[model samples]
Target: MSKEMQEKTIGFDSFPVEIIHDILRYLRKADMSTLYSCIRVNRNLCKLVIPYIWNNPMPNTYSLINLEIFINLFDEKDKNLLKNQYELDIDDTYQPLFNYTSYIKVLDPRGVRRAAFYWLKNYYVQKFPYSDIYVDFKNNPIIDIIEKSLLRIILKNSSKIENLILDFAEKYQDIPSCNIFLLKELQQGGEGGESNQSEQLSHGIREITKLSIMNPSLKRFDNIQEFLDLLPTICTNIKKIKFYDLFFIEPTMELKLCNVIKSQRNLTSINLTYNIFGLISVIRHQRNSLKKLVLRYIHHNDICLFNTFDQLINLEFLEINECFPINIILEPLIRANLKLVTLKIIDIEGIEGKYDLVESIIKSSGSTLKHLSLNIYVDLIEDKLPLSKLCPNLIHLDLKVSIRVIDEDDDIDVESKKQPTIFNYIDSLKHLKNLHLEFAFYVIGYFEEFDQYINFINFPSLRFISLKDQHYSSNFFKRWFEHFSTMFNKITFYIDSESDEYYFDPLDDFVQEMNDNGLSLVYTFDGYSNFVATDRILC
Candidate 1:
């Protein structure tokens, strides 16, 4: 061997353990399959990657398989309980290489329940192939017991759990109550009598920082109320809370949820969706630390009660979607004089005074706002929008434009007249980096005129452009590329269509031509959404 070849060979394991662990961490976040492959390279790699795989397995595709592994990890006594009571045959001789349960740091009880039900269903189908026993697996008591047992095992063994997502959708009528693994029971050694395990369980519950509850049933609110009561005592450090589809929360349950919200020490983010009401007063408690707030599909009555938003002085990011009475929601936000960093208002159409409300918000937070997304009927606004003048610091802009002509035979240049009123300010946003435009269904022919206003000379700092159009026209892209191909570093065009019969042969040719001209372009048909072309210029 040459002197260079004779030198000590360095392998991945030769690196500092922390660096190797960081690389595996990145792989776990980007691609789990790749991280799984890394584990087979060596025992050292396996040790580092196993924890990532098991840390939050329930939320991933391999949850069912992970559930089986978790079941097998139960002690011999529990294994016997499973076999005798639930008819779940476990190989008592089987043992995992590592204590997999100890690695769980994020628990989704809903996912665990779903996985357990499916596992039980599969087992029953195989056992009684000729019967319809597995058809009613959702109502099975065995599934609930298995799910509770899994949660107990995880909470008993996990060193620290950071996030908990409770998603009890409509179908989940038989969600197990929280009494099975209450902090008191865990501390008293209710099941295993292992003080060390009990201590670990308590510590894990206390460490929870993020919690999400979705589609909670009103009928089962008592069990959820019990869980919420426990959260305030044990999960004081929770920084983020999300509630979804809370359409009919009783006054008592609402109060309980508010208590949980008020108890958090440094809560910064709250996402409320689908007809949530009477929580704004509770949210005001976190006004000092709250930074991000999202309200979606809020009833008009609740929007009127959003008057306390001005008190949230620390808020920087706010998103309102499908909420009516736009002015009521924006009034308080404007009064606060907030220096917001990001704002999104989507799916609020056919409402009067929207333009003025949006304009007021822009003028209020525009100085600090860096990201803005608006879904509105642009043609209805008679005056020019002052986006460029107010939000000068903006870096990203997403606009979903809608335009319709009342008279078909008017022969008026609606596109030329109305497009500038909405987007003429684009050129003045000097700091802008990304511009995303989604055209409405009625505005199919407006892209040609829309392209005329946007070009390389006007928007110098712009690097990325994303366009979502229902109409698939190759001519528009051809003309667009001719005008601004040299300007953008990357561009993504998303062609969304309701019909599946549309062909992309012409678009394919345009992409090929762009690729030949020193630009890398990829065209992919993504099901109902149709074609997407991601183009990157090869500088």
Candidate 2:
């Protein structure tokens, strides 16, 4: 045997198929570079890795080539049916060898639109040689037709698709002239077009799926309600729905949306953005089965509308962001008594009884809260956010401290800085596992004092620490890093200031030392970082 063939025989070729599958699972979780390397090792490894790599393929400029191959796979009868039924024009010259669409399990229509546009540009450039074609493809109805056809075919062939995201509405909102159905002329020959397209789209999808419609910016066509109404037709069993940036037109339309949400009998997770009064109806509809809820960017006027949350009896995870008129939200939150395991509150406006509400939530759900995060301004020492006393079982905690600058001549409010700093209560949370502290300070002395408080805190159960500062040099953080022992499994330091090579160079060295010692370090300076942690680390 040749030397190369003899050596190749000693590699993973000898391993069992089950062992190879396990190795691919680990590689699937590894970085993109590692996975690419694994598939190149041998034919067996490549075959095993192809499924994992193609499951959630990253659609980019090059993806158009693969998409072209998939498009060519449509049989002669399928192409003729599309042309005759939907009035779509198909190029039949190209024939495909592989059934590429069957490998796609996670579909993103936005990515398909991007890939379609790229392919169209290249096709036009090559076709119209010697002509300056500044084509406005975004407004082209043909592009929309092509994208929908591709999506329809993939969904029809790939029965394994369990996760789907259709977020093109926002990206295509600027092109008002282009509509999904406008590309196809009426099958009967005039204007009304075929009414069975939604049915055809529905027939393509054969499995229940997790769906995310981020910013369905379809108000221009007066079709937001129509789109919402069509979701159930496409997927009979939607396990989770993440709807963001939804605009409420009127009470009647909102009622329609509420009715549509109510129809999803299997829905268990509802994440809705923009707290309109209409959302209360949705919360009321899903109250029985909903276990997780998220609402974002609520105005002061909408605060009282969420008294509907009190109805979510089975809710285990609740998150509210940018909630104004914090007073109104507190009472309902406390009254809910959800015994939630996770709670996150951010950018709360209003002061009166706000701290009391924070304390009340902890006291109410203290035993069950495994994760808690709060972002608010306060007198760290005097505010009644009793963390250590109230929460004894918190596994993850995130606190963002806001500091105000005061002139030396002005009378300092000693009430704000009465006794101990925010760190004084840290020792009380004996079960705390992960902690993130964020604060901004202008004065150097205040920064030093804050660091001193952190250095003295006793965090025995802490496995991860994230420190973010807006104004401070790396030297300040280096000194703070020296205080913690090797018990910490991961440490993150982020400074939001202009980049300085001299200051950041040492921090990089410190991060390298931490990594060498079996601890991970994420150091960012000037809004840039060397390490970017994924969802796995935080979870």
Candidate 3:
């Protein structure tokens, strides 16, 4: 090392305890997380830092997590820490979560059913003030302990939860059970049956609000009459309905969904995702009460589906995912006089096609639209969709861009070619605030002189940006921090993991070196899921 560089010293004990804590608090949570892992450098430092470390949303990278568990295995210490000291921070955009769900596997089919039962029962059976139950017993193999147990629970305590979400995935032995279960639950008892059990589990025609049956196995549900009886009660209370992943909403499924919409006067929010449900007639008819609509991943192969959207009057948030198979004409969807706050789409490949389609939508109804999320998979996005045009008033945009390259050759031609950045048109964005961009981690045109084509981004009021699927190295991350120091108060870097503690202090000397300079760190992402990358600017 040169004498000049060696002379740059990282001060130790240069500041008092209060100033040190202030500096540490000002640093990004990611930096804090990185710091906590290396706390063993000094025992006194460990005592001062470990408590606050849990408060930061850094990735739990404890190799000895089972050890962290061993340390606070009881309700006494851990619960106190969680309430008084540890702040539980949860970000939904981090893709998947890292907790226990990842570790546990289904060793047996019965185990899955048992797990589903307790989860669903606890989640749904609490609405004792309402009515109805939709236990998804379709194709459930064997009348095992799980089936008998769930059937008994619903049969005994049947009058609550107006809207029920059922897992209709096919298995076997579910036919006779579904038949017996519905008949027994929906059957009202005779006179003198108004006893203690009847008073609590009141069978005075339970009203159902909506039902979303998502399991695909439909061959076993044989109790049409009993299921239809529940439909009448659902019709009285249910406003909107959906049948996900089932191509031809069975004759019974269609009857039940349709009956509920026609019978329930206040129904709203009808979502039939994956387009397997061929009951657009029911969907269109319920347009008056329906406000939130979502249809995605359905290979409908029908142009009429797009043509029939004008019938929905109360539509608000619309999300159509992976609709490449279906030819979606965006014109009618925009002109339909419905208040749209959010419009999300997928498989819109060509950049020009997307820009043009969106331009037309903005020309028609873009002013009224507030939020838009689009995921496009293409090599290079052209003109970057001039977001200032269509979404001029847009607030939340979950924009995802995936560019596939063969390899890093870097031998491609230049000079005669004129390719600019995807953010060139951002100058006119006066109304945008929270902008999320998912692309490569590096800022393409950053760190250049005045001769450079693109200068800088100034989202004066912008607060949050979530970059999915982009992981950065330690050095690049530090440099990136210096570049965007002016943009945000909180910046989060998300990775794909959630296990392990992502919170650990980087070397004290390294942090002190940066502090001695003018760098400010804010946040860090280092879990099997999304945790906080905590850092902030110093100067």
Q: What is the per-residue lDDT of model 1 for residues 351-391, given as tens digits with 9 covering 90 to 100? A: 34476777777778867999998876655565656577878
Worst ten-residue run, lDDT, model 2?
Answer: 530-539
By TM-score, the best candidate is 1
TM-scores of all candidate predictions against the true structure: 0.84, 0.74, 0.56
**Residue 263 miss distance in model 2 (angstroms):** 0.8
Better of 2 and 3 by TM-score: 2
Predictions: Cα RMSD each: 4.1, 6.8, 16.6
Model 2: runs farther than 4 Å from truth?
A: 1-30, 58-63, 75-98, 125-131, 139-145, 168-203, 216-227, 233-236, 247-253, 300-304, 348-352, 378-386, 404-419, 441-448, 473-475, 485-539
lDDT of 3: 0.48
Clash pairs for candidate 1: none
Query: Could you arrange the candidates by lDDT from highest to lowest?
Result: 1, 2, 3
Give the alpha carbon lDDT tens digit for every residue of 3-82 in model 2.
Answer: 99998778667889998888777877777568878877877777777777767663644544445565565545556665
For each candidate, what is the lDDT? 0.71, 0.62, 0.48
Q: What is the lDDT of residue 8 in candidate 3?
A: 73
